[model samples]
Target: MTQPAQVPDATHRSVDVPGGRIHLVEQGTGPLVLLVHGFPESWYSWRHQLPVLAAAGFRAVAIDVRGYGRSSKPRDIEAYRMLAHVADNVGVVRALGEETAVVVGHDWGSTIAANTALLRPDVFTAVGLLSVPYAPRNGFRPTDAFAMMGGPEEFYVSYFQRPGRAEAEIERDVRGWLAGFYGVLSGDAVPPADGGDPHFVPPGGKLSDRFPDASLPSWLGEADLDVYAHEFERTGLTGALNRYRNMDRDWEDLAAWDGAPITQPSLFIGGALDASTTWLADAIKAYPTTLPGLVSSHILDGCGHWVQQERADEVNRLLTDWLRSLPGRARP
Candidate 1:
């Protein structure tokens, strides 16, 4: 795959992993810093951090996470499983000539980064999680909780539990679905702390119906949206949405890591308006306890789900500061 034409200041490359070739963008020269993006986003999601980390004397590499952007996109639900994705990430670090990398991720990517650190500390020496908290595997299946829901209308994840359903609805208007995902969760795009906007779109309704914003946020320009739209159009959302489909299987697969604490130097950053803080409040409160090596945790006031993108400077500052603070690594 080639580099995305739209994003600036980075070079794209691919790493051959167990399942397929993984696409990524790289910058700089020193201890490696790996950035993993979340759903509906690409390596461009880390556009701000790449240059900054490079400038601070660290090699920064951001990837498409298998199912997105210039990377290989597999159709099966099992392909998006976290362990497989984790293996690909570990492979990226080694493929890039580093025995270990400072792994950082946002949104669903945070879950991937945390799992990698927990299961393969030898490969991921340190971790930095954004938006999502790393909760210890308690042998509890999240899919079972969704199963007890009154209906799919209760939560979007429940709605996404079924394969082929969300893809049919959202892919019909990929741009709108992307816009709605950004709009509702974004602080600037919606009222602050209103709680009036619906988080889950009921069946038969277009995803855009939940996004009351007349237009996309100013920061996310049409040019940026085009980059994502083009990539998703090529890959389709099947592999991407497959992450949500395997929650039960992921839970069962992670039983081995149950009660295991993430025993690596870690940093966490989140936006105050990010819904994960409220919806997953239990995990947020238990973050330090679960992640024994948490060096710091910060939530930027007045920010939202797209924390790294929306508040790039703050995110960069927090990240670089944490990188400098970590105990001396053999590579660093």
Candidate 2:
């Protein structure tokens, strides 16, 4: 897991959107490739991809996704709904002076990217999803499905519905919490099998209580941890957690696209050990229907939740190969 060389020409700027501004870091100069990150993470999560994509002869851009990093944080929880995120992605492309571009994401961003491609296919011609698979909107309420997942304990999503519940637990020690959370999810270290499930919170218990106290993941360094902890330390966890509280709203908002499939060129990469892959195996199996335009799908052996970071070289190769394979996006 050798780290990629630092990209020297990378630059940062903000683009004006309806609600506020989006802060992004970009490099290279070819076809536009917009990258959206997921929960508890920022553009920094794509540090490895930005350089690789740029060197592959394409312009690569990664954003802070509104609630994380330097992006604007709207006060209302409803503002973080799925439609709002889709709008932000649209605004980013328009603000960048491009008519259309490629959009890729991981974790929650995977859903956001899929919706963006679904709602505005004209603007995002191609899509790539990592860590999480694309599952179209369904008739059932999201909260109801999550509730049934945990028999006695509360699912993590349900636990996050209350505004200040998870905040209090995480804010108590941002650094330690981030470390434990990241460590337990990486393939290098997993939550003990004997211990209770990390996805469910015991009655009257905290999520971090199940986190591993082991060292950081192989790809994450002390400086990297500081970068994440510093942002949350200054901004608090309200903005980030707001995304989880809007599950039902997204389900309701995206009703029009119910059972819709992304028809644009698509790629999906997942970590074999990641719960996201194991839990949603059906989604991948249904890719033939849900992701009709999917070009390829790979589940990296021994990898974990952090697909891009944990296996930077392999992810970069897959992303670049897929991008080049797109019609007219190929480099010499």
Candidate 3:
């Protein structure tokens, strides 16, 4: 790991990329580790991991993806295409004056990091994916996959595909929507089985309608919640929603890697209690086949979808350990 020229304690700054200006929170002074945040989140999502990575001899640059936070939010739905997202990230690395670095992502960002590695391994040498596993492109539109899932009107992604509808509901009450979504998705929130009405989220109603009283989890504090709410209030979910609108476009864009596998060294960290775990269990099982260079796989018992935040220490340990394990990762 090579050190950065000047690694400050912590700083928020802007970097001009090809797509637009990106707001970032950076720390540390060693090998570059770019952290991409997911939906309904900003660069703040990686606050906990930033210092940890910095301490472990890494230059951690956590950026708000194009749509969210202080980054540019192009109104055109087409602007949020997958290829554009990948390009922004690649440009961020170049803008930072680095050739290559480790790439890490969570939730939707997981897809970003994985695809970035798949698409440009020369730039992202090693990869770390949290929450979501790497799903290979199957030459079908993402909407097609969701349509095949064939759920009720409440099938979340299907509902999101309707455009203006989701944004209307979510943006109507940004803070409430944030609290509701975070509340229901956390590890502590149990999904109702036996197909009950008024599901954790119904197909017709708003996200805030399901849970009247929204509270913060241990990992997510009131101050943290406030930060998220403030940013969402400023951005108004348009850019984030636009990403969903580009689902089919992303599927169309990634046709080049139909059967291609992510050949770089990779590590996956997921939560066992997370509903995503059940489906991804098989993916992890088949990881050797899908991610041929997978170094290890771990599912923390009782952890949930918000694995990195819910269990910051564990996640940081897993991430730094994996980076150290990479060939030539040693630094003085």
Overall local distance difference test of candidate 3: 0.81
TM-score each candidate: 0.93, 0.97, 0.92
Candidate 3: tens digits of C-alpha lDDT, residues 1-332: 21111224788888999889887888988889999988778887888899989888889999989988878988788999888888988998999899998999998899889999999988999999998888887866677766766355455666677768878888778887787677667777634333442223454555455543545666788877878888887768878878778878877788878867899999999888766767667777778888999998898888877888899999999998999888877557
Regions more than 4 Å wrong, model 2:
1-7
In the range 1-332, model 1's lDDT, one tens digit per residue, is 53375445668788887778988888888898889999878888888789998888888999988878777878777888888988999888878878888899999999999998988988888999999888877865887776665464546777777778778887898887787788778877665243444655555654456665568875688878877887887788877788888888888899988877898999888878887866677887886678888899998898888888888999998888889887773234
Index of the highest-lDDT prediction: 2
lDDT for 73 in candidate 3 is: 87
Ranking by TM-score: 2, 1, 3
Instruction: Supply candidate 2's per-residue lDDT for 173.
Output: 97
Task: Provide the lowest-lDDT 10-residue window in model 3.
Answer: 192-201
Candidate 1, pairs of clashing residues:
none
